[model samples]
Target: MRCLTIAGLLFLCYVTQGVKHFRLGRGKGGNLGAPGGYSGEKLPPAQWFKQRLDHSSPSDLRTWKQRYFVNDSFYDFNKQGPVFLMIGGEGPADPRWMVKGAWIDYAKKFNALCINLEHRYYGESHPTEDISVKNLQYLSSYQALADLANFITAMNNKYKLQRSVRWIAFGGSYPGSLAAWLRLKYPHLVYAAVSSSGPLLAKVNFMEYYEVVVDALREKTGGEDCVTELKSAHNQITAMMQTHPHIVEKEFRVCKPFEGASENDIKNFYNSIADDFADLVQYNEDNRISADVKYKNLTINTVCNMLTSPGSEPAYKKLAAFNSIILEKSNQTCLDYSYDNMIKELRNMSWGSEGARQWMYQTCTEFGFYQTSSGEIEVFGNQFNLDFFIQQCEDVFGKKYNADFVQASAEWTNSNYGALDIATTRVVFVHGSVDPWHALGITKTQDNDAPAIYIKGTAHCANMYPRSENDSSDLIEARVEIEQYLAGWLGLP
Candidate 1:
């Protein structure tokens, strides 16, 4: 789950009493990722609430049902206790986060109320009947933040918390960026924030994404042999796309033949394979499953072993087998190599359609986080550049979203939300050393209050996962330090 990290705020500073700032960093002494949190129990139900469609624009009076999950089992309404809120990510709102996250563990110990709020336009929070470019005008981070601010006010009024409750925000990936921005934009509203894997900067090209991906491969495995094989495999496909287009079609078993395929088509084919590996490494924990897999514990290391195995020789065969296995899990008989369909789905905006259009709009307009492999390193966010992005914007959202306008928007986003020049207090930035997103995040503390930390060799949002016996010692220490900070902030002694 990921979304644009933007928002607005009101002055609630004098409304509270004791909200302290926390400055914390990482624990240095272990491997990168830990096992995914194991659970076999059914969690609680989700409670939906009516949220304004555009809190930022008063003229556009529309409302949508925003989905939220709560665990007040530990809360005492009679007493003003802390609220551990999980800000939802790009995808649908999952109540499982309440149990899968670290906050629930903290909730029981601290007698806190745990809640997870779904982002607008994602999950069941569909504002309009359809997600046309015209309808999505209100789907910016600015509106989402306003929605959050208004939601807080409404929830407080409904529960009668006197607007003085301790509110601690938590999120990972894009949501992590939102958590940090929430505190920055609405300092008076949010008491504190724990932003894990939050990319703070807004840029058109995000090449460092792959740099870290390559680094993750080497660091996690303690060698470059695996990476070397992967790179070789990737290059082999590129060569095949050029010389033997027929073979490329036959082996990849694409929905359509590779004959007369444009430059974009070939690049997209490569991306299909590239993104699969990326999801594996990004969520590179033993218990973490691949993006689309029925295999319970499919992992990057295991996949890498398969790619480099003695029998899996020749890059084409390895790629074909890998694709076959992953697609078969979803009953996909043949790979859908239709970028045109990809474009169509990106615009469908239906409940079931992937949220590609919205995310692409965000990239073209707000942050050009395009993953071009040609940059410094090549792994994640690769295979494209500004030209392709510009063309896609025009095709997707009309002419207003040109490169000049997008570049300017990116600059303004950084300036407004403290992308490059962010100044803040009462927030701790958490990152994994091998996470590509951290290239934009605050890994190094510029100010005393905003201390960025890294769990060495870990992947994206690794610390955000629930603690397990298999968790690295460094991750355990990282969580402990975070708890200490939160406890001290709320004056829990």
Candidate 2:
């Protein structure tokens, strides 16, 4: 049996409750949406869910805040339009994604009541006081699903439309996984669901993430040359780390020099690179329309443009330019790409850390969604192996958390939740070819109602983004199919 150390557990708990917020970006605030940007649209009152500390235990009750955004502008309960529920994810529940999301467009057309519910442990929802491991016993998907079950009951009871109104679920990324799981777990609540780019599978190691990124970059450049050049550049950087470490500090412009840093710091510097394309692929949208891109068009196409376009700078310098782009996007000034800072960012939730503590806990305990790289395909591989994550558990939460315990947790999660053998109905698993997460999503289906729509050249939850004129025909079709599925399930004419 594996165990967690009390010291690490106490440290995590203390960090959760008392970590001070330090200024990082220009606005001195964390980025919620785009670079240095928030919805600016004020969030509504957060409703409380009479939640249980542990769904399994059910004895410990807590008033968990469920920060939900509602738009009833086009509601027609008289017409009996279904309720469109947008399940929130790993980050704070920003209503702008719902207000400006493609799901809302469907809601307006369907004359439905649009609702965006924040996930448990995210936004203002706190099942426990401090994010200590002991307190985090209730922070699993099962607990979150139970909270949704309660929310459904509450919403129905208040509205007095328990049997009269239909419910449809929609979400992107992690919430996308929740949306689908909700349907599978409680089909009675969610009549139908649209899981956009949801990573439904659980695994200890996910090296294919960077492989997909490289493949996407390859397609954009019309050849393997782009990936080749990047791999070569990253190889040189890694070699330089051992031979002439001073050059890395000068080249990367990192806040702290890595002249005498630990292995974690080296891994962090590599992670900084991996996160660049990882984010772009995860949130990419239509490349044709210039303005619809929320992330300043940080697409694979853009990366290829930067890498391929000729400059007088050397190859290493060009690679450094790519790193610069990610640093700028991070919105943190004077940020040392160090492991300590990474741990700080992960632990401190008050500092606008995007629910990382909560998510990392879940990842470490339940879903090991760690995105690593392979030496054969990616630029920096073996540097971010599974042991790196195991060490992370040792350093951050507790040294007692062994690989065996983590691996067992992942297996148990898959067994309880049905990762591969998930039996469900009326779920539209919409994913893109370019999305790295989609590799773990529901790829095939035996049921006619449960279909997986694969879009080409798109990335992440682009199909779920607010539709634009320049939106690809594939995305348009996927959205249409979702509407049709919901319509069929809800018995709408």
Candidate 3:
């Protein structure tokens, strides 16, 4: 996930049709006025709450308005039903989450209020004027948990529920980790949590991520030949970079020539190509009805078919041809893997920069989830390594964010969060076997209190999406099991 962000491969486009209407306070909500609305449901208007800037310091009185959405359509106000809080991730928090997702289904079943809280420095929840390294000190997971605590307390008082109402937190991917941590750090506030495809461990050199990608390729249909050809293609490209650099540039349709490119540029170029496969396997069939339709056809099986097609062309040529297909679909004129360009883009503190700069800062300070290809058995070559990513931290943020600092930061994160050894109860950790991020998540049952759901053939965050008719039986059963756990926790039959 971090690798895709670093390589600039993650597209930030959400396709929503029709007009979006916004209301200030909790009002009677209707349909989103869109044809593809989720069961003809509408997302509640955006709301704001003043949150503390520095939750650790008692003297600091500074505050900022954080964005959130509330949908109490299914709330059993007289009975004071449970509250389902969906934690936003590295990107902006879509209000649609308050109306859709499997959590909304659960909210309907339990007659609970659905609230979506935007993470600080993401979406409309800007805590500081700029994302400078000094300003980003308040953007850690510790502060985020504090935000959730304060928000929950404020909501409880606003609704006059006090301690009677139970709060169930939900999140996927990076937010998934935050959900679990929220329950661990503030168990009194969060009764139970659903952490789907959450990476619990903080690792510096995550070579296993790529190993899982190789494993997925080898296990899919026609994937055996695809894996062999992929390895050979990467070797060929590595050799050509050393001798015939011009040919490599021409074949890959690089935006800029590599005649005077820096070593980091070459490494980034390799990473951009490898990230294609990683992106495919990571998302796979996790596409829900609300997801971007552009990436629906791009899957593990689709790429494997292209790589294993019958032809006299060399494997490297076939690999380049596959990249062209991606370039066309993404509407990218040519590949731009310049290290300088990436640093320049990330240095911008404007809101238009989205959460890329903020997320990169988090990686440098807290989690070093660098997906390096150092393993010899990986289909992708060894051009990109831990040092490559660590250097970017120093280059983009500052000199103090070096390798030693990163190592200490990761160690501190694991130590503070308890990593996989977290002593929490009523937290269900759900993961897909094909999801590479599951390598760091808890897959086995830790105890009766902290059980894990390891879905066999699903991809990243598959259990969090809305139920689809085309879903595998394994996924349907997993959702049913999750419902059972939530029902028991909520004191329902």
Candidate 4:
């Protein structure tokens, strides 16, 4: 026993020593470029261009605030292989939070630099003044693409990358929309892109998506319970609103579920509420729950903090603030189910028009709080409770509101900026069937000349097909598509 114990101690010491030695050796290699080759040459200058880093850069020391014109924000970086520039959505630009965990691991696998550049007015990338409707107009997609272009030029000069370095601009959700736009705007700057669950087609149907959510929930939960409960809650809430109009109209006018919510509002309500749950289920089937479950309410605390902040105690100031904003912007509603235009589109089952209308309503509302004029918000008040929900949207947008200014924004969206057309660049779009935002991802009705990957049961962005558990046949096929496409671009083995 004593001998065995001694041997055990020796083995433990041996393993510990090996680990320490390995770490020390890693340290001596001077940390840039792919791992595993120790040629004993003196480390290259800090600016030396390496395809991948020998080891990941220290996350703590890596974050530094960089200025681009009026905007200032901290940037996190992985100083390795071909740099992957990740443009985030409309929210704060902490790449760590936005891309979830997939990016960190992906950096290691590809031996590429991972850079998270925060969008202007988001996180540390704030402009000199608070955001409001008047100034919010500047946050247009065109302006953002310019910012990205500038940032890339700055980084290239600072690092003195060997020649024109290959970069991959990628993102999902709002950022995904931005990614597609950026690729079109600056193809030379971006070698390749992967826009997951991105909504490029701005003219999408917001209300029908509520229906999709309902169908998805019913399909996943295996019951009318969720549908029944949600519908009941919705009807009860709507009827309660009619009775206590003040409570809804003045105090808590939240963004109504897609479609001004019909007598079948209950059914519509359940679908909207269940959509996210269905997304989770489609991605993770092991934890499926009842149809009657309000998953958002359950994960509200966790999810809300990530998406928006719940203010104060007692009655919850955040909720109250949300109500106030919604009431103020209630005028700019969309063509609800009752509207002749909407009815016509529905009767024809016009997918494109419905999608465009929904996207317009939802995006405008979410973006409405930042509009510069009252007219814009008022125009779509019935369909979108812009004023009522502006505060809530503000919580997520991380900017101050300027109702008058933002109200003027309706025109730009209405006019349609620089015609949306086919791109000369190699744009790769991906989407999940279950996502409410899927309508926006549709570049064209039929597959266009550009490459696209739509995972059958997937949800948002890097979520549907998890990098960790993508052993299924469909996932494998998708992976092959990605690998082949990227390989062709990268000339990889």
Per candidate, the number of residue pairs that clash is 10, 1, 0, 56
Q: Could you tell me every candidate's TM-score relative to the true structure?
A: 0.87, 0.87, 0.92, 0.53
Query: Against the correct fold, how does model 2 do in TM-score?
Result: 0.87
**Which candidate wins on TM-score?**
3
Instruction: Give the candidates in order of TM-score, highest first.
Output: 3, 1, 2, 4
In candidate 3, what residue range of length 10 has the lowest lDDT sum? 19-28
lDDT of 3: 0.76
lDDT of each candidate versus the true structure: 0.66, 0.65, 0.76, 0.39
Q: Which regions of candidate 3 fall more than 4 Å away from where they truly are?
A: 2-40, 289-294, 376-378
TM-score of 1: 0.87
Q: Which 10 successive residues of model 1 have the least lDDT summed?
A: 20-29
40-116: candidate 3 lDDT, tens digit per residue? 55557889999999999999999999988889899877888899988866666665566666777888899999888
lDDT of 4 at 350: 27
What would you estimate as the lDDT of candidate 2? 0.65
The parts of candidate 1 lying over 4 Å away from their true place are 1-42, 286-296, 329-331, 376-383
Per-residue lDDT for 89-144 in model 1, tens only? 55566555555557677787788888778778765678888888878887777777
